[model samples]
Target chain A: MKKLRMSKATGINFLTYALVIIAFVVLQVMGNQGMLSSTLKGQLVPICAYVVMALSLNLTVGILGELSLGHAGFMSVGAFAGAVANVALSVSVPDTGLRLALSMIIAAIFAAIAGVLIGIPVLRLNGDYLAIVTLAFGEIIKSIINNTYIGMDVDGLHASFVQNTLKLEAGGRMILNGPMGIPGIQKTSTFVAGFVLVMVALVIIFNLVGSRSGRAIMALRDNRIAAESVGINVTKYKMMAFVTSAALAGAAGALFAQGQNTIVASKFDFNTSILILVFVVLGGLGRMWGSIIAAAALTVLPEMLREFADYRMLVYAIVLILVMLITNNPAIKNFFESTMGRIKSGKKAKGGAEA
Target chain B: MLAFLNHVINGISLGSVYAIIALGYTMVYGIAKMLNFAHGDVIMVGAYICFFAVASYGLHPILGVLLAMLVCTILGMVIERLAYKPLRQAPSLAVLITAIGMSYFLQNSAQLMWGTNQKMFPAIFGKTPFSFGGITISVTTVVTIIACVVIMLALTWFTGNTKMGKAMRACSEDKAAAQLMGINVNTTISITFAIGSALAAVAGVLLCSAYPNLVPTTGSMPGIKAFTAAVFGGIGSIPGALLGGVLLGVIEIMAKAYISTQLSDAIVFAVLIIVLLVKPTGLLGKKIREKV
Candidate 1:
């Protein structure tokens, strides 16, 4: 039975990998055939970045069962840190791909450091308090970034808070112009790069979820007291999950920034965080495959419904509410279960019930 | 010194508005145990209603205020019934997301109906500054402070002396127990939302009058600020909301005046975080022990 269970889990993982690979291949073929729209072509890299974001957020929200309202704060951190690193390395690293990879690594490290700093104090609180603290931290980070000015010159990088005191030489470059964010960034993030990042994120998350620590994290999420009774180090596991999630978000943020000509801190504000949360929630919590599909579909939906520009968000809101209401309704849940049960029986059944 | 006094008065005036808004947030949280993210947008809707009633229809300012309150009260009850009622047994995450969706719905619908133009809120208090002991204050500020005090007193009395208020308290303590004890949990919650929304309307008018910029997104920032105030004061405490709101406003104004204007938000939030870390239940919250 255990072997069967392990095989079933692997089956889902394999399916997820296959789905990503197939989508990449199909999209690549379509682009090569000139069958894709210019707008969609531009969105490919961003879509991949968002998919990675959703997956990382799922690690915290779904598996760890913690609602972080400031996921974008980490993203903002990573974006700026990575962008600065990328710009500083422009001379030393002539290769754009190598520079992008190094920037992402630096971004991940900075974000993980931030995560540790925030998660240490924040994880002490439960429920609403934790959510609010994360939000407060997000706002503080945004406010601080809004006042920060960073410029790179022959003298390396100079950063100032609340004052444009960076005395840049003639050939110096301003990496971050306070509220204007990082501009003139070389677009090094490609669809292929984003795809690799997504695969890496998936592998890391899946491996963690299947490990002993992941079980401890989920156990604490399921019941803190019970997890403690079983000798699980609650703080250590929560921090591990949170920092890992933040690091992934940082990498995704670096990719997202590289995909854009200009990046602003405000772009990763409360609304953006909510947008990511919406993807995670709509995709169904803790379901990696569901998150991937939901994030991609929702990201594309707005673009496709450009005709209904005014009503698009209104429709999205109504749909979100309806989905929550319907999914939570006992009658509907029972209906889905009965139908699924029937289908399973008709197929003379597979392995185990994945859920 | 006089400038500092003026700042203080301005801070109090601003804090009074936040206190009123924070009351709504605290009350709803106490009863429903969910953050109504749409409360901010409700303030926007209320402001728009009042703006239309006064600016377009030439109604008396008092009547406009009353009209906004009545409409917002009904809207709150309707939102509760349509969106939140069915999700009573659902997870908190679902309820929070639904609230966010409702917030988006309100903001977008307001945009669709009112168009995203900024309208000047009519100055009902007649633009005269009140000067006393060399300290100048706006009439709107005085009226706002007085109104906050009056509302706080009235709320205290109603909750202490009224049966329905007692029922609300009971429900907040334990909904299932309250239901079992023959208290109508649904009605109590609906009433809580009604009262909360009505206060939101008053806060909306005051907020716009002080700043005078009536836009679809105007209430969002203040709504978030008031929520921070609610949490700072103690999420479930009424007087705590008042204390938190007032202190938040004062700190924000002082920070803006004395420090970099851009960092004022950061300062206020930093104070909140420090306060929460030191006293997680807020200034006046009663600590409850967790059970296995």
Candidate 2:
């Protein structure tokens, strides 16, 4: 029975992977055939980026059961760090794809460093306190980025905070101009890259969730004291999940930034964090496939609602609330489950009766 | 020296507003165990109501404030019933998301109702600065400080003495136990929301009076800062909220005054992080022991 259950879980994972591949192929074919609109085509990379973000956040919020409100802080760190790496590498790395790949790696490393630093003190707290500290950290990161000035010259890189003291040479170029962020970034992110990143994220998360450490993390999440009594290292497991999630988010941020001509610190503000949270929550927390669908649907939803103009956000908010209420309602959940169960059983009963 | 004193006064007044806002957060979190993200949006709505009442309709500032509070009280109860009540048994994260949705709903509604334009909040008090001993203070500052002190004292007394307040305390301690003890947890939560929203109205009025800019997004930053203050002080502690708000305000002002202005917010949050690292439950938060 246990082996059967394991096979079932793997089967579902395979289904998820298949769904992604099929979707990618269909979209690619459609794009090649000129069947996709420009707005939708532009949204594809961002949708992937958001999908990775949702999945990463689910690692922390769903799997680890720790609420982090500063996921965007890590994203911003990755974006700026990745953008800078990409720009700096332009001199040495002549290949665009290679440069983008290296930049994402650098971005992930920086974001992981940030995650470890933040998660160290932050993970010591529990519940809302943890949430608030993450929020404070997010704000702090944004503020620091807002005041930061980075420029690269022949003399190497110059960075300053709260002042424009970058004495660049005649050929020096500004990488990050305080609040203005990185401008004229090479649009190196492709839909294919995004798709591959999503697959990579899924593989990492699935393997982790299937591993002993993942079970330990989930154990700690479900019952901290019990897990501790069972000799699980709470801080270590929590940090592992958090830092991994942050690294993945960093990669997504890098992809998102490289896909755009310009990236600003403000783009990864609290609202963006909340928006990603909405996707994760709406997707049903620990369900990875649910996250992908929710992220893709919601990312496209705003563009689809462009006709509503001013009321777009208002409608989205209402839909969010309604979805939460409906999904969480036990009565509605029971009703839906019963109907689905009956539909399956009825089909089986019909086959038996025919036989 | 004179400039420093002025900054302190400005800090105190600003801190007073944060204290008022933080009180609402602390109370709701205490009772409901959910961060009411819409609390900040309620502050915005209150500010808009008061703005229109006083500026557009020429009502007395006091009357306008009262009207705003009344309206916000109803709005708070409505939001709690519609958006939050159904999610009572849901996960805290789900409730939090619902609260975020409510916040977005309120902000967008405000933008749609009142065009997305910043309106200068009228100075309720005349343009007069009170100066003494080489120190200048605006009347709004004095009024705000007085109002904060009064509200704090009243809240402390009410929570310590009133029957309803006792019920709220019971609910906060353990909702199941409180319900078993025949305390109406739902009504208490609703009342907490009402009082919190009413305080939000007063906070909105004072916040705008000091800064005097009214926009749909005006309350959001301050709301976040006040939420930070609530956590800084201790999530559910009233005195902690007051202390946290004042210290945050002072630190913010001092950071901006002495350090780089742009980095002040970072400094303030850094201080919060340090404080939390030292006392994970905040300055005055009681540590709850876990049992398996």
User: Alpha carbon lDDT of residue B224, candidate 2?
Assistant: 94
**What overall lDDT, based on C-alpha atoms, would model 2 receive against the true structure?**
0.93
Runs of candidate 2 with Cα error greater than 4 angstroms are: A338-355
For candidate 1, write residues B1-292 as lDDT tens digits: 9999888988988998999999999999999999999999999989999999999999999999999999999999999999999888888888989999999999999999999988999998789898889987888999999999999999999888999999989988999999999999999999999999999999999999999999889889899999999999999999999999999999999999999798999999999989889888888777879898
Query: In model 2, what lDDT does residue A248 have?
Result: 97
Candidate 1 TM-score versus the reference: 0.97
lDDT of 1 by residue, A71-120 (tens): 99999888888888889998999999999999999999999999999998
Which pairs of residues collide in model 2?
Answer: none
lDDT digits (tens) for residues A1-355 of candidate 2: 9999999889988998998999999999999999999999998999989999999999999999989898899999999999999999998998998988899999999999999999999999899989999999999989989989999999888999888898999999999999999999989999999999999999999999989999999998999999999899999999999999999999999999999999999889999888888888898878899999999999999899999998999999999988888888777778888999999999999999999
Alpha-carbon shift of residue A56 in model 1 (angstroms): 1.1
Indicate the TM-score of model 2: 0.98
Q: Indicate the docking level reached by candidate 2.
A: high
Best by DockQ: 2
Off by over 4 Å in 1: A335-355
